[model samples]
Target: MPHILLVEDDAALAALIVDYLRAKGYQLSHLSRGDEVLPWLRQQRADLLLLDLMLPGLDGFSVCRLVRGISNLPVLMLTARNQHLDQIDGLESGADDYVVKPVEPRVLLARIQALLRRAQPAPLAELTRGQLHLQRSCRRATLGGQPLELTHSEFELLWLLAEHAGQAVSRDTMLQYLRGIEFDGLDRSADVVVSRLRRKLGDHPKSPEKIKTVWCQGYMLLPEVSA
Candidate 1:
């Protein structure tokens, strides 16, 4: 069973969520104040987080940002702030997904399921290919045994590519996995991430042999790349 932590000031809503999710076989716990979340997380373990914007202490955005810095815990901001900018801010703060209030219970359940699925990778604790090493639990990666300083998104992209090593991972697939949206053909986020990954991986900037572009397909991480 996946453990879920919820930070919400609304008593009624918190009770509702806890009851509903618990009935669905999830281990649900609620913290009424944002200030208590981080300390609680350090002592306890949870598979995912459900955050609310209106809280007693720190706001949801701040909580999400701080948590992201320390862990790759999937954060889903479930807030009443339905404004367009609020959603953008939540995502930029490192939330895995954002959902507005007045949402159906079934929809909420689906979102939780999706996040848990993404967070739980293969049974392997570490994935290694060629000279690259990735520790899924800690979100750490090393190239030739040297640490590879990576941003959250960059690491995520690398993990996805490494999982599908030797096969082309299309921009649409990457967009959907990373941003929860399909590529618009005009979006260059995937390409930008690739460029950063190549630089960090020391791929030839001019000829790029490690992560190669498959004309019209997408990017492929060669199973064997130089250290």
Candidate 2:
């Protein structure tokens, strides 16, 4: 079962969310203040964090930023404000996803599940194919023995592709896997990230051998090329 840490100040809303999520088979830990998050996490392990923007002490953005500095734990921001800027700020601060308040419990649960699925540990300690090596413990990726400088999102994207090497991973699956959000068909965020990751992997946009485009289907990492 995935352990989720919820940092929410609203008592009523928090209770509702906890009840719903617990019923869905997740182990949950709740904290009412943002400042208490890091300290609590240091003492206990949490697979994911559901953070609210408004807090008594530190704000959600600050907490998310601080957590990103120490860990790559996925953060899904819960905000009452529906403003686009708020969502953008949250993502910029290292939040993996954001749920605008008046959100459906089912939607929240689905997001949580997607995030956990992408972050689930593999049977092996590290995964390697040819010159590419990924260290799961440290979330590090190296190509041909050279370290690849990748952001947390980029690393997750690459890891997913590497895991399914030689298979086409659909864009919808990629979006849910990396962002903990559903693809709306119009969202190009996943493509942008893939483009950046391809550049870092030394794959050309016009002729991407490492990460291949499957036309309208999705992207694939060919085992032959990676090996």
Distance from true location, Cα of 152 in model 2, Å: 37
By lDDT, the best candidate is 1
TM-score of 1: 0.54
- Residue pairs clashing in model 1 are none
lDDT digits (tens) for residues 1-227 of candidate 1: 99999998889988999999999999998999988999999999999999998788899989998899889999999866458888888999999997789757898999999999998776767789899999988999999989999999999999999989999999999999899999888999999999999999999899999999999999999997668
- Over 4 Å off in model 1, which ranges? 123-227
Clashing pairs in 2: none
How well does each candidate superpose onto the true structure, as a TM-score? Answer: 0.54, 0.55
After superposition, the stretches of candidate 2 with alpha carbons farther than 4 Å from their true spots are: 122-227
